[model samples]
Target: MARSSTNQNVHSADDSSLDAGGARALRRGLQLLDALLDAGPEGLRVVELCRACALERATVHRLLATLQASGYVATAGRFRYVPGPRLGRAAAAPGQPNMAVRLQPVLARVSAAFGDAAFAIVRDGPHSHCIAREVGTHPVQVLVIQVGTRQPLGVGAAGLALLSALPDAQVQQIVAANAPHLAAYGGMTAERLHLLVRATRERGWSVIGNHATRNVLAVGMAVRDARGEPVAAISLASTLARMPRERQQLVARTMREALAPLAV
Candidate 1:
């Protein structure tokens, strides 16, 4: 009876300790979130938040992921954090159709036509962010991206298209800033991205194979705003067997035609 009582006491102590640890983690997460809210849409880099919150790098990354999953924090570029939609500050003004809303039909049409996943991506500073997505009728669905996912300036097909549209000087600056983050993605480096920029500009469309996902191929093209600046991009993603060289060209042309009348 005495031994049983002792074991119970030990278990109770462990439970208390775990509860305390959980509470501390929650408090730290809130601190990180507060830091992001103060940073606003302009956002703050992970290192900046680590300094501001006096937290370790790994801890800050974990907290940011938790907050982002809950819609409290959003990533802008590779590691930059911004206040998310849950904060109630919409990016759109009153009466202006949001870019996501305006592009939904376009994405749906592309997905339906190609029987693959289609995405709408926009330029967020030096990053490309997936703002909307559409899944096709194919039973074997490949969901590689979702809304709010952010990629470096030249990392993915959408990003490559966006980067290819920029002038040489601006591309150099953005590529330099994103260089360090590129290594994390398999075979992606600053030099390689510059090569992709050249090829994408020459082809008038970006083609990425097996980079974002194994054995998946994606074709992308930039959508110009009213001023003729490439402000956004659209991509069609399918298996390698589906996107042959000939099919890629055909899809690129179709994407250009579909997005021609889009105002923004």
Candidate 2:
């Protein structure tokens, strides 16, 4: 009887501790939600939210994921978080298209011009997700990543473009966070990613090969939002034969011309 009573007491204590932890998480989530709301439509970057909420990056990232999953927070552009549909502040109107739909025409134009696959990717925390893709009429195409595919940021041309556009400090933080998963994608390491970022920044574009797909080459350009912040990236991919050094530069310039008039 004594042992049974002790077990019951321990279980109750454990339950109580769990309840306290859950309550704390709830409070932190609410705090992050409030911060997103306060930032208005332009939204706040992770760094900005960290500064405003006085929270650690990992904590803020976890809370934001929960909030985003619940639809109370949404990504505004590349790295900004705004109030989501649950808050009724960012709901789309009737017949209004989202970012992917709005970008389809641009993707089509790029693919048509190059006879290769064009892709658009957006940053989601430490990862990049393909939100749109268009295939050209080429006889042989390199369709490496499809829509809805997610991979660590800096692993491919489009992802690297997105990574390169972020602040240097945030970039370092993200690279460290994604270090463990880097080996799965072509043995990528943090140091290699840092070098890639430097090269991309210096070249004003990104070109990566044999990272996301074997023997495939891609050229990527970051698309800016209205505020001149990177919101997404566009990449054109083909075989190495098709994307020689000169052709890579040509593709980059084509993407730049195509995106000259639009902002996410």
Model 1 lDDT per residue over 17-133, tens place? 999999999999888878877875557888999999999999998988888788677655455677765653354567888778888888888888888889888765567789899
Please report the candidate that would top lDDT against the real structure: 2
Q: Which residue pairs come into collision in candidate 2?
A: none
TM-score of 2: 0.74
Candidate 1 matches the true fold with a TM-score of: 0.66
> Once superposed on the true structure, which residue ranges of model 2 sit more than 4 Å away at CA?
1-31, 37-65, 71-96
- Candidate 1 achieves a global lDDT of 0.82
Cα deviation of 229 in candidate 1 (Å)?
Answer: 1.2
